[model samples]
Target: MKLSLKKIELTPPQILVIGFAAIILAGSALLSLPIASATGKPLSFLNAFFTATSATCVTGLVVVDTGTSFTLFGQIVIILLIQVGGLGFMTMGTLFAFALKKRISLRERLVLQEAMNQGSMEGIVRLIRKVIQYSLTIEAAGALIFSIRWSFDLGQAKGIYYGIWHAVSFFNNAGFDLFGPVTGKFSSLTAYADDPVINIVSMGLIILGGLGFVVISDLLDYRKSRRRLSLHSKVVLSATGILIAVGAVVIFVFEFTNAKTLGTLSWQGKIWAALFQSVTPRTAGANTIDLAGMRQATQFFMILLMFIGASPGSTGGGIKTTTFTTLIGAMIAMIRGKEDIVLFHFRLGKDRILKAITLTMIALFLVIFVAMVLSTTEEHPFLMILFEVTSAFGTVGLTMGLTTDLTDFGKIMIALMMFAGRLGPMTLAYALGPKTEKELYRYPEGKITIG
Candidate 1:
């Protein structure tokens, strides 16, 4: 008798995402074991699950203090999850497949196309190869710089490890720190903020990682061949610059006299903190100040920054800077009664506009719905709940002190939000199954009176 088995195939994105979720869940379960904790006590299932999801999503909201709760092994697991999550499991899987000399199927290419948001698959394999190469090179450089700086403060071996871990965490925007109470101590980076080496290196890593691989690829290719940058790259870079500059100026001006966080800092420290705060909310969660102690205005500003996070196809999350920019352009065009939405001399198609609007609407609804649910369950103030929801949905992870107090249901809600934020609502919707095509019908174009 002969028996044959059938091969099961999944789109690259689906396999990558589902496989990562499985790995995270399993890792969380294993880490929940008694031996995984620094205190040798097993963590509750919910806490373990929450931590795992947060790490895998590269979101830093934690149910327990990472520094005190988990052992080094557990922390390593979390870091690994964050790194994988940040780079994306599909990219890594494709790289391994390529290394193994496995031929990528057409379906896999389509999945890859979706994953990278590429316009074509002609050079996707090469692109993935370059992405891996560039990511590792940059991350290694960041780790080395951090390691040298940390060596002066911490011992040699520990410093090297911390440097590598934090370099990955910060660049990936994972925001998981093992600095103990010092994580929240917020000395304005006074101890290391002015180190120049640490600040510059960390900021560089954050910016490069958040810039999106497509932009990096374009820049690299352009430098090699002296070509012009793509319109997408132009838009992304322009928007990013404006947001960073505006955010920094606003933060510096507002907190100059708060006396609690930025006010007490020296001029140099204040500028450094302001820059860090501004850049961080673009979805990188590293902080030079205590977030809990910030003024209400600063927090509100942060909420806005977090909502318009790093660029598309980047390690960070949120609606994306490009999406936000495109929407703003569309709005301006509409206000001027123009039919075309152009940016950087390139016209954005209606499909792109519709998609952007849909993404923003879905993201907003998710945040608001989760906030309402959490407010009811946790009894937190509306603003705090909204902040937490936005943080989770943006995968920004800069919480205003409500992460640990969430009930089981609330934790699950947040986990779902993080997953949605990272994978994207549209992608998740696609993965759930194909949508039904509209049957026969044409609706009349109707206009409604608006504000």
Candidate 2:
């Protein structure tokens, strides 16, 4: 007698994302119990869920002080949540499957493709392995450097733990920090700022992590052969560099006379703060200066920086550098009456241009809608609402002192934005599953012209 066995199906990306989110929520609830909190007060389930979502999304927006509110175990849970969340749930799932020596299924490859926002599934398995290796290597290096620096500041044991925790935090772009009191205090990083080794190492990790895994893979490949960088890498690197430099210059110019923040700083301190502000807004959520004390113009500038965010396929979130660049390039091309959309000597497809435009519009709309909702529910100014919305959508975690005052509805809205930002609006859309319906008839094209 022949017996047939039924095949088990793997979970879809949406289900997987939700399941992981549930696990994080449950974990946060358990950790928020009286025994796990620093104040010995049990956290409300809503607060715990919000915090869990924020952490899992690698978003730094917190209703409570992470350092003061959570115990060591709770903090560890948040860190782990960030690690998995930053890496993408499917990516971690794939790594576990690989560790078990299990064959990666086609569905898994598709999931990985969606996770990284790659155009193709070819070499996705290899890409996933490389991503894991690269992440570990970078995180380890960051931890080592941080540990060495922290050792000199603190004792060996504390420094070692600090190093490891911060390394994971920075590399993952999760802004949770042990420096609770020092968060808004610029005096905390005074020692580390001058220490070139620590500053450079941390910034280097941030850059590498924010550069996107695709760019890293491309660089690795280019190293073996003296070939040029891929278009994606070129665009990402060039846009990122230009944005950082411009942002730094803008910050330096604007805050040079503030007196409270950058104005009173020495030349070196000013430059360091400016540079940190510029770079950190690229979705790292680490700030050297007091964000609340910045000039309105500077705050607006930061909003733009946070919105543009880091490169695609990276740990950081935003509209992405490439998308911003492409949208600008497309506009320029259109204004010049050019039929072909070309950038870096390569012609961009209409689909790409359309996707970029759509993503930007959707992101903008989401931010605005959430901000409007918050304005109505929370007792904050419109500017503060905008700041909070941008913070959530960018996953930058920098707030203008309004996070704790948000109502339950406002928190949930921001939580949704954070989730969408981290997973990516497009990825979340795709996770709902693609809508594939062929049109039976083509409609007549209508043309309208406007400036």
Error of 2 at 29 (Å): 2.6
lDDT per residue (tens digit) for residues 93-185 in model 2: 888898899999787777777778888999888888999999999999899988887788777897888889888888887776776643443
- Candidate 1 ranges beyond 4 A from true positions: 1-17, 181-194, 438-441
| Model 2 ranges off by over 4 Å | 1-13, 181-195, 432-434
Q: What is candidate 1's TM-score against the reference?
A: 0.93
The TM-score obtained by model 2 is: 0.93
Question: What tens digits encode model 1's per-residue C-alpha lDDT throughout 234-310?
Answer: 99999989998999999999888988778888788888888888888877776777777788898889998888888
CA-only RMSD, every prediction: 2.6, 3.2
Q: lDDT per model, in order? A: 0.83, 0.82
Q: Which ten residues in a row have the lowest lDDT in candidate 1?
A: 181-190
Worst 10 residues of 2 by lDDT: 182-191
